[model samples]
Structure formats: structure tokens, C-alpha cells
Target: MASNIIHFEKDIEFSKKVVLNTSKKFPDPKFIFSETSWKLDQFQNLKTKLNFVKHKLNDFILEEWHEHTSKMNPSGLVVNHVRKHIHPDFLTQAWCKFYEIMCNSSLVSQKSLLTGNMCSVHLCEAPGAFISALNHFMALNHQSIKFDWLAMTLNPYHESNGHPDTVSDDRLIFSTIDKWEFGPDYTGDIFQPRYHEHLYETISKKFDNGASLVTADGSIDCSDDPGEQENIVMSLHNYEMMVALNIIQNGGSFVLKMFTIFECNTICRIYLLCCLFQSVEIQKPATSKSGNSEVYVVCKGYMGRSLATPYIQMFFKSKNHDNALLPLSQIPNNFIDELYNCSSYFCDLQIKTIEKNIITWNNKNESYKEINEIQRIICQEYVNRYKLKPIRWDQDVISSSNWSRARNNKRKINISYSEKLRRRDLCLQEEAVLLYQEIVNFSNSKTNECHEILWGRCDQVSLNISNVKYCLGKPVIQVRSSKFCNDSLLQYRIKIINKFPCIDSLSNSESRILYFKTKLNYSKNGINICDLTDTYAKNRNNNVILQYSCLFNILETLQQKSEDFLLIGYPLYTQIAVACFFVIASMFDTFAIIKPDRNFGHAFAFFGFKNLENWLNILSEVLKYILPRNDSYTRSKLALVSWLPIQQLVKQRSHLDIVLLNNLCIAYEVEPILLSFIQS
Candidate 1:
């Protein structure tokens, strides 16, 4: 293949000189750059030189790659131009990298690696781009091979995974959630040792031996400490390697993303990789920006696991110890020289390109004819070399039978509200089971009075009413009812919240209740509820818009008060109702859902307003449909609830898993009562 690739092989004589024997003490890394070693000094000096230009030229250099160089690479531009659906840029980068590696190396063509049935595992693979890329490759080349794959990453939706730490994009995972293994804790954090064990066991069960291929594109944000990028990501690099070594099949191929090879930890890891695989090749794909230090290590033809067991033990055991793997003095002198040369080569290339980009940025009016010519040649070469064809795997991926199953599981697992009543045969969760027992006990009582149960729990502390500075004077809780709900039941629930006519009995409630009615027009057929089975319901969309407008208006008046909120009864059987519920729930720090009646869907109580401004953009999209339009172009804004993708809906939904579960528990309990009432 016509690509920039550097290959390394195991030197038998050099390997004999080093200690390959087993030892109880793990091979740890501890090395400092010394003046005596010119190779180390040279590598460090080049890095220092690169850092000098980085501050001012970083953005210019990146723009140069994105706007010019990467587009010149044929494979990089192919996917974007030919694929029907849009995807993350990393998807195309992964495809280009893998395509070059597969073509240049003996990964795909080798019979030993391309078995009839193959399995692969991707670590730190959120929003799964590499998996999709591989799927496309297999469909094009190895169509007869049965490919089964698994992936894991920091769970984006898990509350424990905070911002800047997890991949918040769920565009791909929303459809392929089942293929991911998020460990026993469901955090998908590979840094945790337990996750490694769980992933190993899972791979073992499916492949028996292990996965035929393992890929890890894990990295940490080192922008804060750019000089120590290698050091900052050293521990993660080790963990990824250990997991891959443990889960990969004998004669399998392993691909890992890494940075510069200057640090002792990095050099040691690369040397260890060279010893385990028949060949280790480092390549910075044409798609990757020249301004960055990112590169992929493609290791192929793994020696059997038994042979690597001792090294694996050392790798894991080194975690707690401060010992050195083969100290700086023990690694082969020839290998050290090769490492220094490789580091300097890439560093020099980066520095030169950065300088050129700096000039280009200053010259703002630079001609693009050269770039266009380069792009034409590369595009032609790529099409001819790979037999390129239009690829559209985004729809093909989500349209599988598993999509429906994953959607169903998402609802049942307390991720969202269920449009339909809970089925008796449906498996009940631990929380649901306990709530069911509570409901049965309540049903056996003789009292017929209306009641409100606090089934949902939110740990968020209520705002201190005295310290508040919002426009609203006191804490106010407004109760609202939709046309679909029973007005008598709604009034009774409001009375319960207000503790009406019992104020002299020494209660401590200070909040005042206000009642509002939704202006929904009821028809003979009632509200047309649409479930996930139906993508769109055209009849009752206007009612949905009216409800959205009412809620949006209510939200517009909200302030950051401690106890100012609305207790609303709305049916969640329609997509718009569910979307609007999420919008309201997300704006409050503390929220709960009440099942005021057995036949009702859900009644929500949101408290302590927060993040209201952030959601107003989406809510405002509904108003374009409600307002009068003057031009044809202005009517393009349809109801976001009906037009938005399921993934977008999932991403916008609040972290109200408990609230969903609480409502579902009531759904399960009320099923029998509603059934008996109907029979009578």
C-alpha cells in the first residue's frame, strides 16, 4: 500500500541478550533522560523545538490538515462523499487507517487470521466508529466470514460519567447498545481492573479461545499538560495493552492508538509489543492531521497466549510496584537507537509542516490548485486500488432486528416512560417488585380517599426558600390537568397536595397550590396516542403542539426558586408528551412522577428549577409550527418531537431513571385492577 508505515521485527540475537525469563517482580518503567545518551537527548531536544512553534501555529496547522491535506487523501474523502448518512469524522479516519493497515500488512489476506467465523472486541469504543468501519470492510471483502463483535466504553448516560470524561454522543450507541459490554458496574471504564476481567470472560464465552481481532482507540485530554502527554496517558496505554493481550486470540491482530515514543514507559510498551507479535508496524495514516502526534500501532501474528502469559502477569503485577521493567540499561541498544530515530523522524516532519502552515495562514490568499490536483490523483488511486463503492451502513446497522429489542429494553430498564400499560408477563425489576408489594398492601385497606405516594427519589437538596432571589415571592406548586385525565381525580390530588381544610391541625407545609387547565380539544376518539411501533401520528399533532405551547409558556415564567414548580397530569402514550416531559423534568434538580389514578399514564412533580434556559431552544422549535408563517421557507420547522431521531430524544431526556421506574411500578400494580374493572 502507498502509505507512511514503519515496521519492526523481533531480533532473535538481541532478544537472546535481554532477559526473557519469568520473574515474580513485574517489569515496571522508571527512566530519566540523561546527558550521556545522545539519542535520548536528541529526541527530547526535538520535542522541545516542536513545543516552541505549537502555541501560535496549532489552530492554523489543524485547519491546514482539515481543509487541505486530509481531503487530498483519497480514502479519507471517499466515505464523506459516498456515504448517505453523516457520521463523526473519526469514523472516516478509522476506515482510512484500517484500510491502509489491512492492505499493507498481511492482516486480511492471511488465511490464519481470516477464519470462517471471526470475533473482535473494541475497548474504549463509545459511539462505535471503528466497529462500523470494520463492518463495512467485511461486507466488501470478507463477505463469507461470520463476524461477531463486542465493544465497551465509559457509559455516557451513567450519571457517574461526568462531562469531558465520557463520549456524550449516543448517535451510534442508541441503536447498538446491546453489542456493548459495560462491565458488571456498567461504567465501561477500562482503567478499573474488574472491567478487564469481565470483558475477558465475555470474550472467552463467545470465541472460546479469544477474539480474532482487538482494537483500542483510547486517549486522554492532554491539552492542559501538553509537554507530558505521553506521561499523562501512560497508565491508560498500559491498561489497554493488558486488556488486549488478555482477550486477543492466538495469531490474532491487535491495533492500539498511541502518541510519541519518547517516554521510557512508551518505549518499553512498544518493545514488549515487538516481542509478542510477529510484526509491529507504526503508521500515521494520511487521514490523520500532520500537526498532531497521533499514530496507530498495528500488531499482527500474535504468538499463542500461553507464551505471553508470563509477560501478561508482569504487566498486571507492575501496577502497584515501583520496579523497572528492563531498566533503561537493559533494553537492546539497537532497539533504543531505532526508537530515537522514529521519534525524531515524526517530530521533524511535524515541525516542518507546522512552519509551512504558519506561512499559509499568513498568506490568506494562497492558491488551492495544488491541493485540488493532489486530491484528484489520490482519489483516483484510492478508487482503483480498493475498488471503491458507495457505502451506507448507518441505516443498515440500526435497521436490524436487534434495534427493536434494544428499544424495548431501554424502556423496561427505567430509561424512559412506557407508552403502553405494563404487561404481567414482563419481567419485574427489584424496585418494581417492592413497589408492587406496597401497592397490593394499599389495595387491601378499606379507605377510598385519594392519595399521593412518593415513589420516586431524588437526592438533590431543596433550595433554601429564605435565601432565594428570584422574581417569585414565595414557594408555589401549581397543579395542572390535561383533557385526557379525570378533572375530579385532578382536583382530589390538588387537595391532597394542599392538605385542604386541615391547616389548623399543625402541618408544616408552606407552599401554595395553583390549578391550571390545558386547553386541549377532546374528540370522540379521545387523544390519539402513538407508540414506538408507529413513527408518526398525523391526526393529533395539533393537540401535541398546543400542549407544548402551554408548557413552554409555563417554563418561560420559571425562575431559580427553591420550591416553585408544577405538578402535572399528562398521558405519556405519545412521543410529544414524552419529549415535553423530559424537557420539564430536566429543568428541575428534583423531580418525581405520581400515578394519581390507576388508568392514568403519569403525573409529574418537578422542583427547584435549573437548566431551563438550555432547553428553551428545543422547546421554541415547537412554536414555529404554532405561529403564523409569512413565507414558504418559514414553514420548514416541523414539530421537533415528531421529526427528531430517537437518538436525539434519548440524549435530551433527563437522568430520571428512578422516576420512570416509579411510574412503571404503578403501571405493573394497576394492571390487574383495570383488567377486573373492565371485565365487570
Candidate 2:
């Protein structure tokens, strides 16, 4: 009664009779089962017989006798050897077998026979090793053919047993509801009979006719009792078969993963598949571990829907009755009864004994010790292959005491305030040059002909003023003192207003002369004005003309503030320069502010102009004047304000609408009058 002794005197005779009887029934002999034996002499002889018969039949099952022997002595070296070469997880072996069957069968060739493309569907597929296996097989064997695939499984976001069912590999890509290339929608819970209509509709929309290959690796939670486990697996198998039947096209193939063929429901499913397919064979590839009961039902050459409709209807109608069984009387074919008998005999003689041996092995303490040793060995090997050296944080440190002292002394010598100022200025100049180059390069890459005009103007400005340094030597504005209160501030403003001629009369030279005289008189306390005028006439070449109308508006506004403070000798020209820089910065800043809001459509359009060469050239001129100040905070603020608009605009447009508006304001010579509009 030992579990390892599967074929006793009476059972060996019965196994021989069942194999001979089943082999005789197949005319072409497509259906065949390799026999199992317990005795060493009988097992060796059976292997020799299988090799001889394998060449004759296209499909043949290989019985697993080695695992039964290892099960009797659970601490044997054979178990350790097998574990070392392959992953202990059974799914790895199952996927390997699935790949082998697909390649060896005509499924690959037949898939593209009707249509130019091959399409497949996977049901209840998650943690995706099956798909990974298929991908590997196609990559190695048929590299030229392209195929489409769709997959449906439980949503990983949904909670199951306090955790989501998620893939271990993060890199898998396929068709699903959230991430898909082929289908508009995905089918949910194909096991439910009510979900069948949705499933069919989804497949019809995704695949033109139907999928050429359908694979179901679906299973449910099993109880400790073998009978209860068998019942749950059988119920799940029914749902899996229903899906496979509905989706597969004519001449398509199906591979169903199932436990050993012991239960009556498993026999019924096999019989149904036999009636629907041209050939049906059960196979357990070498990659599948010998200890497990899992086997694949590889059904090939699907009969068309017209031929399968009646049988399918009867199967569905049986759901309402007790036991939900498809009556044996309804099957017109004689092969059903014969297949059932063969499957029953094979299970009783081979699988049941193996199952019992597995149970006996599971109860042993040595088996647990052997498994732990195998895992430890695997971990050690993995570490040897992939181990990396630890990073050394102090690698760059100077190890010699003398070298460290020398470096510290050198750093201290270079840390003076004046030296720091010089280095800081040098850094700022380098950054400004780099910024200018980046702007020019971006303009060259993205701008059009209209943008080039603005760039040309920028080039002109840089070339014309390259040698001219606008070093206004601290020209001052006098604030009116309460003690020396005079209406002279009002009188000076009126005098400037009268001298500032109409827009048409004020030529560039005339404007320059008027601004210089006003600045010269203000610095001299509005008294010794003739002396300053004479001095200005002597050094007229040193006075640079401020041409921008916005500059005049800023000067006038500053004059007003100076009068209110009653403070004199403020630097008028330097303030005007800073104000002009602010104007340019504000325009770009406004564009950045409006870019993300949908309601600011006009502002958004203005923000997108691509021709930034004019803007870049103008900014470069202003930065050249500001960089000498060596103020990091101001430089950083200016850089950020200037770069934001350019970055946003570079993606789309190439025209400078804002620049043209500023230019038109200057051309009209009405900057002071239009100061509100410019500021807005």
C-alpha cells in the first residue's frame, strides 16, 4: 500500500489494457498517452518505447515517473539538482511548457492562413509570465511575423486579500482598459455567464473576425480537502471553456491549464473539447515539474461557430439543472465515451499514486530542510553573479596631512573681500556671455524671416554702439528744500516743456541736447546753469543720447518724486537706465503670468511669439550695463524674468508683436503722453 508502488500486480495489467485499447481506437492515432510504471526496469523500458513512438505520432504525452521516485526519498539529490537548474516556482515551468506546445504545434502557421495578421487573447492572465514566455518564443523562433494581443485579468488596483494582484515585472506592455493599443474597451470577469455578451462585443470590436489563439490559465482558491479542491477547479474550468469556445475562430487553437484528469467534471470538459476540435490531446511538458498535477489541454483546429452552436446551447441549458452536467446521451459522437474511459484509467493508474506520494513527501521534515538548502544555494549564486562594490565617500579626500594643510592655506589666501568681488564680477560676465549665446542659438534654430528683421535691428544696435560707453558721471537732480523754497521747480518744468518741441520738430539731436541741458541744470542746483551749459558744450561727446520715449517718462516721474522728497543730487541717468530695464522685464514677466490661464487668450497669443532675437539683443545691451554692478540677487532676478518668456515663446511663434509696439511708441515720439499705455 506504499504510495511509491503505483503499479502493483493487478494495476499493471489494467494499465496495459487501457493503453492498448485507447491506442487501437485512433485511426490516425493522433491521441496517445505515454504509460507510467513504478519499477525501475519498467520505467527505463517505457522511456525507450516513448522515443520510438514519438516519431510516429504528432502528439504524445510523456508520463512523469522520476518525480514519484524522488518523492519517496524527499531528501534525494535528484530533487536538489532539479531545483538548482530551474526556478522552484511551478508557473515558470508551466510557461515554458506552454511555449513549447505552441511552437511544436501548427498553431503559429495556421494563425496567419486566413488573415495576414495573427491575433491572440489571454484570459485571467496577470503577473504576466505566460505573455512573457510567448514574447520570448516569438522573438527567438519567428522574428519576422508581427502579432496583436489583448489581455484581461482582475484589476490590480482593486483590493484582494488586503493587497492588489500586481505584476512583479514593471516593464510589461499589452492591451488592457487603461493602457491599450488595439481595443476601445476591455472585458471584465469573463467567468460570469452574464458578462459573456460584453466579452463577445469587446472581442468583435477589437479583432476583425475573432482571435486565432485563446489561452486560459484561470483557477480559483482551493481548500485543503482534495474533493473540495477538485470541485472548485472544475467549476472554474467550466467558465474557462465557455470563454475559449466563444472567442476562438475557425481552425484556431486553445491551451487550457488544469489539474490531473481525475474529477468527473474534468472528463466532461475533455469530451466537450473533443467534439468541438479536430484533435484534442493532453500534454505535460518536461518543464512542468513532475510533482504537480497540472496538465494542459491543447485543443487544435476549432470547428466553425455553425457546427458548435447546438452543442454550446445544450451545455448552457444544463446550467439550470442540478449538477449542471451536459448529458452523455446528447453527444452524437462515440469518441466521447472512449476518451472518458481512457482519461479515467490514466488518472486512477498514474496520477492518483503520484498525488499520494507528494502528500507523503510534504509530511516529512527532511523535505523542508532540503528546500531551504536549495534556496540558500540559489541566493549565494545570485550574489556571486551580480554583487557590486560599495561606494567610498572619502575617496576624494587628501590623505596626506601636508597636502591638506597646503590646500587650506591656499583657500584662505584667495578669500579676501576685494578678491571675492573680482571673481564674482568675472563669473557674472561669463554667465552673461553664455546667456547671450543661448538666446542667439535658440533664435537661429526657431525663428522665421519676420523674426530675422528684429535680429537684424539687434545686430545694428550692438554694432553701432559697441565703442560708445554711456558713463554718465553721476548727473544729479536737486530736491526743493523748504527753507530755499522757490517756484523754480515749477519754472524749470515749464521751461523744459516749452523747449521740448512738437513731435515733428524734435529730431534725435535736438532731443539729445534738450535732455542733456535739463540733466546738467538739475545737477547744478538750477543755479550756475550757464557754467554747466558751457561745461556740457566742452564735453558734448561724453554725453550719450537716451532715445527711448519710456526713458523720458521715467525721468519725469523720478523728477516728481524728487520734488516731493525735497532731496537733490539724485543720479538721474542711472535711474533712467534701471527703469528702462524694468520696462523690458515687466513685459516678459506679464507674458509668463498669462501663459497658463485659458481666459487670457490674447495675452497667451502674445506670449507665444518666437522671434526673440530683437528681445535678446536689447537684453544683452541692458545686461552689459548691469553686469558691472556685480549684484548676484539683481542678476538672478533679471535672468529669470528674461528667460521665462523666451522659453515659452520658443515653442510656437516667430514674430515680435510686443517689440514692434514698443518701437512704434518710440517712433511716434509720444512716450511721455503714452506712458500709461506702455506701463499697462
Name the best candidate (by TM-score): 1
Q: In lDDT terms, which candidate is top?
A: 1
What's each prediction's TM-score? 0.56, 0.40
Candidate 2 per-residue C-alpha lDDT over 92-169 given as tens digits, one digit per residue, 9 for 90 to 100: 444555655665455664656534667787777664556645654554455466667777664322111101122312
Give each model's clash number.
Answer: 2, 7
Runs with alpha carbons beyond 4 Å of true place in candidate 2:
1-91, 109-116, 160-187, 311-322, 331-337, 344-680
In candidate 2, list every pair of residues with a backbone clash. Answer: 477-569, 478-568, 479-567, 479-568, 610-653, 610-654, 611-654
Regions more than 4 Å wrong, model 1: 1-39, 58-79, 84-91, 109-114, 319-325, 391-395, 399-512, 515-680
Q: Summarize candidate 1's per-residue lDDT along 39-98 as a digit string, tens digits.
A: 356667876877777765333333344554453332335455434343422344566656
> RMSD for each model, in Å, please?
21.4, 30.0
